[model samples]
Target: MNHSVTLKDIAKALNLSISTISKALNDSHEIGADTKQRVLDYAKEHNYLPNRMAKGLKEGKSRSIGVVVCSLDNNVIAQMLDGIHKVCTDKSYQIIIMQSKESEKLESACIELLYAGGIDGILISPAYETINFNYLLSLQESGLPVVLFDRLIDKIHTHKVGADNFKGAYEATKHLINNGYRNIAHLNTNTILSIATERLNGYKQALADHGIPCREELMVSCNYTGATSLNENLEEAIKSYMSLENKPDAIFTATDQISTRCLVILNKLGYRIPEDIALIGFTNTELADAMNPPLSTVHQPAFEIGKLAAEKLFSLIEKKNIDEDFETVLLPIDVQVRASSQPSNK
Candidate 1:
């Protein structure tokens, strides 16, 4: 009564064994309904607390997962987190979230901390600077399940879930071209990341398919991660394109941040959307509809990606064989056309 009540204390007070008290508290079917109710009521009244560390020791799992993302400032990331949280809640599991902020050191530290914290599984979106996946490999080798989502790697053989970047980018580019924009530019991210590289390829392929030659100078890479002056960098890229003698008549940005930023930069520079330079971007931001010209966008299935990733991680965690076959799930994307990408009046 003085100290925290334990299963032993509950058993002694109720004239039952410690095992019965524990099972009743856990709602085990082996215990009678009347006895289970009595135990639950007594525990609620007395505030009987179970030793979580001891339970984890017995089960060899913490019943918790660690989630890492590059950044959560974007609407896509926020929606993805909602999806992950939903699955975790349904499964009666807990999650610890972390942000890498696109730093390799921070990403590695997050993984290490999660592993040391006794997490049963990890869901991660690799940072832009994360080139080495040895730490992830080590975690899996040490009996922890890991599922990568969004920004994944080719070196690690693990479960992955992401949107089809190639198809999305190609569709966006073709949409712009079909809208009567001949000279188009691409605002991209780091080429090392699969997301960026795949998108760039798709844009080029779309141009080739339409008999439009790919112009190297029109392609500009934006460093969203670890950039000291992101706005200045993007402004410079935009100015460079606009200053060209045969500048781009339209632009397509690869990521959510890049897309939104391009719109802001273009507006600030006095370029009219769809009239001066048509614009299309890959983003999930709801405010895209409220833009001055109603921005066109390639919408990634962020929520579905998060849900699939978490479900896959749980599958790996619960399975007996850690080396079972892994999978890479690619969800489709939707291209929403708006006034920003259309020069003609609807």
Candidate 2:
């Protein structure tokens, strides 16, 4: 095995104290420019890397963050994790990622493990089945920094970052209406999280604005943590919508997974998009444009959300105070109109 050089090795070579070497490398005012340059040059020549973990431990920080999300299978979550990794790399910090698999029990266990593992902070996107947000609250109360991203929970007040779910869903629904799609149906996750409720309300608001009566039968919440698979739940919901006396001319989905999966299910069921029924949803999949009839979508700034969330968690950790007013950031979302949502006459 290759042995890595440590500060002690550099100190011994330079015949200087470890304290002086550390101060010089850190560019402390106590160290002169000449000394700093010499230390930097020698360290570079020897290919020395600072032991961040050790130094962070000495300073009462782990220099590592815990990231908890639903799953890495989704492109949206993957993009967000990419942003987090980039920021962590730049900051000389490491990230420990864990998946909740959209289960509240599993999400709680992840948080507990991260906290017990001595992570400096946590950035979590609550699972759809999560409701006992107080679990995170207990951790925050115990001085462990906590930040919420992607799916914001109002129960715990901390630095929150996510997309504008309401406006995103609203724009998708409104676009379908403008394109002559009436009797629009909405499909969302079976959860009480703000992300779900906000999107559902957005769809309702758009319908009301257009003088269309909101029908409960036109909306369905797909169960994610049930005995059946999410695919089966979605199929049942879609079938129910089609059986309605006044079937929707278009359907608006409320999440990244739901958005793309809805499209795929529709295709598998032999339904012609835009001709049989138009479709649009909030998704950030790269395959959207390549789909047989391209998909219209409400695109969220997933990467930015992740980046900001990680940055905010660091700020909170450094501040060592969560009593101050926390920031709730909602980044704007884009409505991408594609062939799947364009009127057939066009």
Candidate 3:
């Protein structure tokens, strides 16, 4: 095996003390510029790189942040990652990504591993199954600056960045109501995530504001099971709704996946969209425009939210304090009214 060169070897070759070589390599103010240049040039020539782990141990910083998301298969998360990458790259910081697959146990394990790895900070869009904020609180107490994005835990006092879900949902629901959708139903997710709750509240508030009574039975909660199971759940929910004495005239889906499933199920049941059942969705998915009738949707700034979260986390890492005066960031949502939600000329 080839032997690795060390600071001691470099010091011997340069006829300088190891501490002097170390200071020069670290670009410490104590070392003269000429000495620093010499050490850097020698290191480049010899392909000598300092051990990051040892340096991190000495400096109490890793220059690396851990990012955890529920699933990489999600397009929303993919866009968010692009934004995070842009910010981290500009700062010359490394990001370690971990997926929890919506499992709380796996999510906790990932957090523990990142904490043990001496990460300077953590950015997380927690698993849907994470109902409590204790684990996140523990991580904060352990001195790891954590920034929650997209999905959040209200009890945990941490900086968070996310779309204004309530406003988005309200606008989507109100749009449907304005387009003659009196019997509008909400296809809700089973998880009690803060974002989901906010969306539900928005839907309710919109209905109440329009003097429409909110019907509890019209809201169907489906387990978050990606596309396949989501289709199945929507089919069942539609069947039950159609069987009711007063069927829903429209639907406000909580996500793009739910909207797609709604279209499929409605088609399978021989229902004409807009004429029979109007639809509006949360995400601005590519398929929305390509559908038989372009589906209307509220667009969330996923990429911008991710970028802002990463930037805030870096700031927190440098400041080493969580701002107690931090308020919830409400990113703007754009409502695109399309053919699927077009009103009749009554």
Candidate 4:
């Protein structure tokens, strides 16, 4: 008779009790198989939806984890999410994902919303603008398990899973050096990001090891966090590097978008890969192998990073008590050499 139907309505319609309808809907062992099927079918037909919060209160758990990431436009994040999904499925948990879009305000709001939604745990890849972890620390002190991945924050002690950015960047820069590419330029993001700072440190270390000077002028910031100025900043960075009387002989890009876009822009600017300049950077896109010169890349194990972070969060969720000591899992990165960064003749 009413537009909105409840479990009480379904029970009354079927001449049953509310408890019976509830148990049937929840697939309780006490309910007969025939009754369960009937209830499920009826609910499906009538578009009956259970209240998630109420269910969580009843079971004392939401059975869901909240995931926050910077963006899904990049293939690396997509692959990492796939891995997180796989782990969640295996653990009989669900994931609610949100994007911060590289804004700290959005990130803080996402955390508050996920906590209010009663998520049992959280997995976050911090945004470039995320500098404060006080909120996250308060959540942890309040017993909410949080796992940081990829773009991590060191202030909040929690489970961190990410690629070895330092090692990856070191190897990438060394690859360029081994290939006879001296005067290597680094395209890095804002130093606020742990990934950016770690990769830059590795790049500098590699240059020092190879007896090459770390030129400050050759280190450029593309400011990828702000999409409005991303292209313009990248263009200026490239033009500045090229304008030098003794420009860099090689370029090492720090992130996925920076790596791929630099190649495109370089080609557009009439520069030949590994001829006029060598290129290597961090990227996990499938297009790497199919590029015009087949880009050499420092490939982060995105899927593995996701899977590991999910596993760690689930461990914290299922375990009765965990140690105060936190874990930092630094997964290895793979350097795939290709035509773009082949040994230079000169």
lDDT by residue (234-268, candidate 1, tens digit) is: 89999999999999999999988888888988999
Provide TM-scores for the models: 0.88, 0.94, 0.83, 0.84
Write down the lDDT that model 4 would get.
0.89
| Candidate 2 RMSD computed on C-alpha atoms after optimal superposition onto the true structure | 1.9
Kindly give the stretch of ten consecutive residues in candidate 4 with the minimal lDDT sum: 318-327
lDDT of 3 by residue, 1-346 (tens): 9767799989999989999999998779999999999988888888886776777667778878999998887778888999999999877678999998878888999988998887899999988778877887987997778998998778778789999989999999998888778888999888878778988999999999999999988999887745677778889998888888988988899875677778878888998888878888887577788886788888889999999999888888888464545556769989988988885651
Query: What are the per-residue Cα lDDT tens digits for candidate 4 across 151-221?
Result: 87679888899999999999999988888888899998875878999999999999999899989999988
**Which stretches of model 4 miss by more than 4 angstroms?**
1-55, 343-346
Arranged by TM-score, best first? 2, 1, 4, 3
TM-score of 1: 0.88
**Which pairs in model 3 have colliding backbones?**
none
- Model with the higher TM-score, candidate 1 or 3: 1
Cα deviation of 37 in candidate 1 (Å)? Answer: 8.0
lDDT of 3: 0.85
Q: Best-fitting candidate, measured by TM-score?
A: 2
